[model samples]
Target chain A: MPEPMGFFTDTTVCIGCKACEVACKEWNQLPAENGGIRELSGDSYDNTRRLDGIHWRHVRFIEQFKGPYDGRWLMMSDVCKHCVQAGCLEVCPTGAIIRTEFDTVVIQSDVCNGCRACIAACPFGVIDINPVSGTAQKCTLCYDRLKVGLEPACSKACPTDSIQFGSIVELRTRAQKRVDQLKSQGVKAELYGADPNGALGGLNSFYLLVDQPEVYGLPRNPQLPTRNLAKSSSFSLASAAVLGVLALVGLRKRRMDDMGGPGAGGSN
Target chain B: MSDTFFSGAPHWAWLIILYFFVGGIAGGACFLAAVVDWFGGPEDRPVVRTGYSVAAWGAILSGALLTIDLGRPLRFWHMLFQSANVPALMFKGWSPISFGAWAILVFGLFAVLSALGGMAEEGRLHNPALRAVGGAVRGGLAKVVGGVAGLLGVFIAGYTGILLSVTNRPIWADSPWLGALFVASGASTGAAALILLAPGRGATEQSLARLSAFDTKALVVELLVLVLFVASLGSVNRVWIGFWGLVLLVGVVGLGIVAPLRLHLQRRPLASAAKLVLLGGFLLRVATILASEGIERYRVAAGM
Candidate 1:
């Protein structure tokens, strides 16, 4: 009914403000993190443990130092990829995980049976089960907000507009242009989850990375669980067939052995 | 053992390995039932009936374990009611979960019918309608239902491998052979479990021996594939060499494929050795998956 919407996260411009996180919590009514305590993570300013049921939008702070230059703080607001080939969607048994008309992945919380298949299937460790609700929870890309003709809360609240939201096609074009701009400025910025042929058939919400994806806790190659299923099923069937034949032969042999015995024959 | 641990592996990798372990157990149970049912012997019917019941229950339980690990457990139904995403690798055009659910339902129904049939034949149930239902189930109708349910079971069992292989993760994605590996592992474990569970008798012993031989053959194939996969990783992905090497040498050879083979060859009782092998196989899968996760993490870290 509407254009396919998605997120274009430009990691280079992210300031790690985490306003998006606050906005998401406010809009979605998610609970406070660690009872809203101000504790340092020792790793960075990212006190939030990680993406879980309560926290949908996470700003990752990666501290890096290159050559003799002063160390730089890389911040990227991360959310669900809304992958074109979502593993979570495939493995979910209850039909709770669904793709919206906007081509974004969303889980129907009401219908979910608290099966963690999607959590296991997700390559990025983005999804989690809500301990409180006993249901799988992740960023819905603000499906509820989208339905009312408004942008996602996180995108709207981003101070630097790091988490951009718009049509996937338009976003891709904008992302490519941003990458080109970064390259012109001698920055080695590349797009992760951009190539459709790449792992997971690209993501509806892709990223602009200054370094490798793993530095941002992204998997280099995210496989689909179903691919392995087809191959294993065929082999299993063939093995079973072979076993079945052997069993039949064994049955025939047993029958013959019974017939050969003196007490085997009886009046019908 | 310290060297075997891959520091880069995340929590999800461990979770997947657990998933595979449970899935294999469930699938193997069903396979064992099928083999026993097809091959007649003393107590074969009882063995077959028990195997099916265990498998049915085991599958549901394993599925539950997987569901418990999800972030949106309440949204589990979206996999069935929502529009299927054909292009997505994980998209079950018709939810495999739904298929598995139906399979369990059918198998449970069949088990009840068969049990009622036994009761009717034994003069426990005198009602004519009950007898009729039992008779209908034992007739041609049972075969059709069993066939459909069996087919569904196989799919559910095999789908786990496909789910892993479709990812671009090099350690897993490199092998177009994972599916076969999963199937072989499932069957081997299934047969071994049945052997261990079935009552001891000369006929049952002989049946177990045959099943063991079949399992051995499947294990050999799995071993070969693991070797080939590790060897290929030497050139395909250098990091995988170390990670998968440990997995192959320790996890698969030492634990899964070989250790049980050794036990069986030593003339140990079927129950002990079969259980050992099944445990080993489950460990091997978990270790391999975790190793793959580590390698992937390393690749990402190194910007490869």
Candidate 2:
């Protein structure tokens, strides 16, 4: 049908104003944590710690300051990656998590039994249980808004245009250009989850980061759950075979012991 | 970012853990029953019946526990069928849970059939029609049904560990030995269960003793596999540094594996050893699941 759409987050220019997060919550009708009560995280200006069930968008504030001036602050708005080969979608037994026509992963709350398979499967720590819906919840990349030709609320509210949403192809070209521009300006700019051939088959919602992926709570080499499937199953089968042989050995040994002493199996 | 938690907890809690425990035993017991039915003499029928009985009930309980643990328990059928596309079977070869759900379901079917056969052979079924069904299963079809059930049982016993290993969790994904370890533990616990329950149902002392011997070996194998599993974790094995570690050491290793071994060697009552093994099996699931879920809590406590 239609071309796939996604987000290209330029973290280098994020102001950490959290306008995008507020807009996302407002548009999604998501409730505030602890019933609108506020608590300090003691980490930075960020109180919303990370993306979870309620918070579809999290603005992470990282301070790499020696005297608050020598180093720089790295602010990132983290959300679900919506990978091309999404771990959550791959492991969702209920078929609740589906890839929309936009190629963005969305969890169908009605269909989700909330078994939490997606929670364990997601490498980026994106999916979590919503207390209200009692289902695994995460960013849908504003599927409703996209269906109506409107942009996602978070990107729409991003005054600095840090979180840009558009067709995947156009976004990739723009991201590469931005990376080149930043590199020319003496910045160590790198594109994460942008290459179609890369990890998780390249995240539909990718990012441009100045630091290592781990520095942004992202995996350097994120793997699908299938990576361990064959090895684990093979080892399990071997163990089963050993158990079977030992069981037979136990039976034969007992038979021999009985035959040596009284009578074979007591003959009762 | 390194300070942050890498993933969300499944909140599997007690229900899923209990399911793992019972599901393992069900699969193990079914396989053990198949072994006895094929190898043991006519006198060992009681033990085989006991195995089938345990398998059937264990599979049923595992299913119930898994269903109740879901967010929408009524929608548990969604696991087996695509609710969006009615009547379309939901099966994901790549998803362990999907495979597990189908395996448990199919295994339950086989377990129930075998148990029915055992019951009819024991002359417990009164209805003529039911007896005929059970008699046919027990007579001509017993070997084939038992073989298939036993194979599926082994899969069921080990797949839970594989399920964990396939996840992004710290200690779970770190090891490939969980499946082996879980299977070994399942065998031991299943044997222990039969040893405890088979008596007075007509199990001979010889058969019981042989099962005990098998259980002892299974415990040793489980112990070795567990060591490898923990070792495979490398520094991530530190997840067992606190309360969970104590459970693993005292409950799983000392009481579950070692004490039972000691009892078996001393020729003490099989019941005593069996109880200890059962307790250990339960605790193993608890320690493995909760420890990973509480990894973040432990990390903070250790100043990590």
Candidate 3:
């Protein structure tokens, strides 16, 4: 309702410094994800692998060698999409999850029963339960900072302009212009989750990617799990109704059989 | 496209699986009792009484399992709180889990009342005051309560699957028939429980033979729904193929269904079939949960 503030991440200019990661952890006062010891994952220089209860923002380093001379490193900063039709918010058994004024999803930790419904409901696998707190955790888009007119820590700490934060309309315009500029220079730039009509009703935080969405571990077409509930509930309700009717009918047949039997002074 | 991203499986563990199995059995047992009350006369009172007690006890056990699954066990009351629409108490209440909470509570209460009515019918209650209460329940209220509990029982059985279907995970959302399948299995297992408690050789054989006739039909329907559920996933490029799959195919479909049919046709003993169906009922929940393993975060494996 308040202009729908969000982030538009352009991976082309990302430096993959992970300064945003450190800044997020520091600002949020999050504890170590794996007991504080840093390990260089054999995957790449990206040690902090994926977003979990602790890591809300992750910098991914993708290395490719099309042919020794035709190689490039694809760097992307991944964060919660803050989807318009958030599955987590929809499936939350305790109304602990809420969609904020800025259209970002936030979990009220105190109210959460830690049923883990939201964790499974998340399409992007964004939410997780912080072991210590025993409540689901995910990117709130810096709800505390946004309340006081401050940008998210990750976007503020980004070295390059890869992560841009502002009103949804303004960011969409800027991202489209950047995509056009790159295409003119023979770069295959496409905006993912920018179209409001797209699956999941688009994202408050979207991306500009150089390759297929799968290359970045994003769903080609993310869907709201709630959309499937209609079919499931309907089929089930029908089955229950049909079974209940047949069961009742069976009861009637038994009554008639009893009445018509030899004990009732009738033929068996 | 070749990039890999690992996603952790859902947070549910053994307790939730236990809840599903226990709740399914309870729901099924109550449904059978409701059927007998609606149609059968005094002759079926013994089996009907067992159904009532089993449903009541099953509801209590499953309720305990649900409570144990919660992280803040003391904060369980938080589920019943409706912060946004308190004024609409009749229409609007808690979330889905909250609705389930009240549903189970009501079902359990009715089941207990139904059992009391049975006690009165059999002249089992001793104290005059307790006998009076049982008398009132047996007169008419017990039928209404059993009928209401039956509806709630069916709801509880299917809603478990609906609860899982609401998750974005593919293994859950893949099939719209999970609830239908679960209910059918619930009914079959409930019948098996009754069979296991059959009185003696002569009466037991007749009762089991009739139940087997009904249960085998339920099993056939359950099998058909299982196929429909798996077929629904065909377009998604996912298949149930693993240790759990074998358990479902062999343990549930084979032993639970085929063995029961064989014994029922031969008029032979069905104690083994009863055990197999009960075990299969629980294993079915296990198979359903395992189907979701590595469903997400394995984006890299499928080339996303």
Question: Pick by TM-score: which candidate is best?
Answer: 2
lDDT by residue (B168-282, candidate 3, tens digit) is 6665776788888888888888888877764531223444555665676677777878788877766443335767678778987787777776766675667777787888788
Q: Note the clash tally of each candidate.
A: 46, 0, 2
* Candidate 1 lDDT over residue span B1-304, tens digit each: 1111111222355555666766675565565555455455555565555455556566656656655555554544444444354333223443444555444455445545544543443455677898876666654455444444444445555555555554445455555556556666766776677677655312355556656766676677667656655564445545545766666577667777787788667766667768766776776676556655554332243234
How do these models rank on lDDT, best leading?
2, 3, 1
After TM-score superposition, the amount by which residue A249's alpha carbon in candidate 3 deviates from its true location, in angstroms, is 4.8
Q: Rate the local accuracy (lDDT) of all candidates.
A: 0.65, 0.87, 0.76
lDDT of 1 by residue, A1-268 (tens): 7877899999988988889999998998887655768577565577774676777888887778776687888888888899998977876766678899988999887767665556656777677666667677889999888998899999999888889999988999999999999999999999988777787888989999998766777766666656555554465466556544544555565566657764443211
lDDT of 2 by residue, A1-268 (tens): 9898999999999999999999999999998788888798665687887778899999887777788559988989988998999889888999999999999999999999989998888888888888888888999999999999999999999999999999999999999999999999999999999999999889989999999877777777888877889999899999999999987766665567656855444321
Q: Give the winner by lDDT: 1 or 3.
A: 3
For candidate 1, the lDDT comes to 0.65
- Per residue, candidate 2 scores C-alpha lDDT tens digits across B26-108 of 88888898888887778888988888889999999999999988888899999999998989999999788999999999999
lDDT of 1 at A7: 94
TM-score of each: 0.74, 0.94, 0.91
The list of candidate 2 runs beyond 4 A from truth reads: A68-71, A253-268, B1-5, B127-132, B296-304
Model 3 steric clash pairs: B4-B300, B7-B297
Q: Report clash pairs, candidate 2.
A: none
Q: Looking at candidate 2, what is the lDDT of residue B122?
A: 86
